[model samples]
Target: QLDAVPSFRMAVHPHIGTRSLDLVSERDKVGFETVLTSAKLMIQEKLSVGSISAHLADKYNLFNNSVKKQREDLLGQISSVESGKAATSQSSKCSHVVGHQAACCIKFGSNIQFRASTPEERESVPPPISKERGLVVREETCDALLALLTGLKGDTCKTLCLETARNEMKNAGDDNSLICDLTLLSFVRHCVEMGAVALH
Candidate 1:
């Protein structure tokens, strides 16, 4: 199971914070290029005929039974690797509070915001990621993007994807909102063009 994600990557300690992943390397020139490329990969790697067929075959299984299985397999694959890293660290501090509702979120200063969720909402509070107004790719997108971006694999990439998505949504504005909508449509068009998906 995925742990509740605390928003923000800023660290009182080094290499930790609510949204610290937004910060980048000395070798990289652009602020978001490293991240955006990863984001693109997140969407692309899943752009296979199977995934596309899966999306179309079952009338959009983006948040179906398969996702739960995917989550389980992904989490299992990465936990061992992450636990190992945490063990090596002098602090050994890589566990979330047991019952906290975890989410991928965007953090601004001390504030953290949840990203989007596949399942629709019943609660009053907004999910870190928006539903109608925004374009949420998928867990596949998250998995792929994080793998490409942080050079982290297994569950670590999952966390990285959630964190990055949170940051991406957090940065959204009116203009950005329009861009997201266009991006979603563009994604559909691109999927058809790339022969990764077929149009209805």
Candidate 2:
């Protein structure tokens, strides 16, 4: 209801004092002084608000500048790291070329097939999950959970799967089915490797 009302304020008008003493009464002088003091107070209030606003703006600018600096610093660090990685990769490729040339120079009986190292191969390596100290759910259990999660959103499935795995681990005390030692992430990785769940 209050919102419906127009926000209107009456303008302040300072009393004008007459220069002629004969025309000015004591009451008129008092009224003029009262209005003058009120006007001064209003001006002071406005100045106070302006000062506060300026102070707040300064603080905000300082904070914003700090955030920008931090972001720039982070981006710079990331670019340097990326450049370093690129240099390392280039060097490795050059070394590989040199090795290949040297191999060609050698009159080897037959061309030997060399397995190249890759990030995918490294990531696909399974963790050492043992029965004594690791949290491992049964493969069947994982498959079942994953089957239930089909058609669900990726994030929702991931979260739900993690939560379900945790619950299974907690409830799998003395159970022979869930006897392997694995962390939550390792369990998920295992599932991913087994094609039970697709990695996002």
lDDT of 2 by residue, 1-200 (tens): 22232321332223333256556677866765666676666657665767879987888678657666544544454344435345345334432211223222111111111222234533453543544233354453555334333423233324333444445555544232422222333444443443333322
Give the count of colliding residue pairs in each prediction.
19, 5
Candidate 1: deviation at residue 5, Å? Answer: 51
True-structure Cα RMSD, model 2: 24.0
Q: Please provide TM-scores, in order, for all candidate models, with all chains considered together.
A: 0.20, 0.20
CA-lDDT, candidates in order: 0.33, 0.40
Deviation in angstroms for 95 in model 1?
28
TM-score of 1: 0.20
Candidate 1 residues 44-74, lDDT tens each? Answer: 8656789878767676444345455644554
Runs in model 2 with CA error above 4 Å? 1-44, 47-53, 67-69, 81-155, 158-200
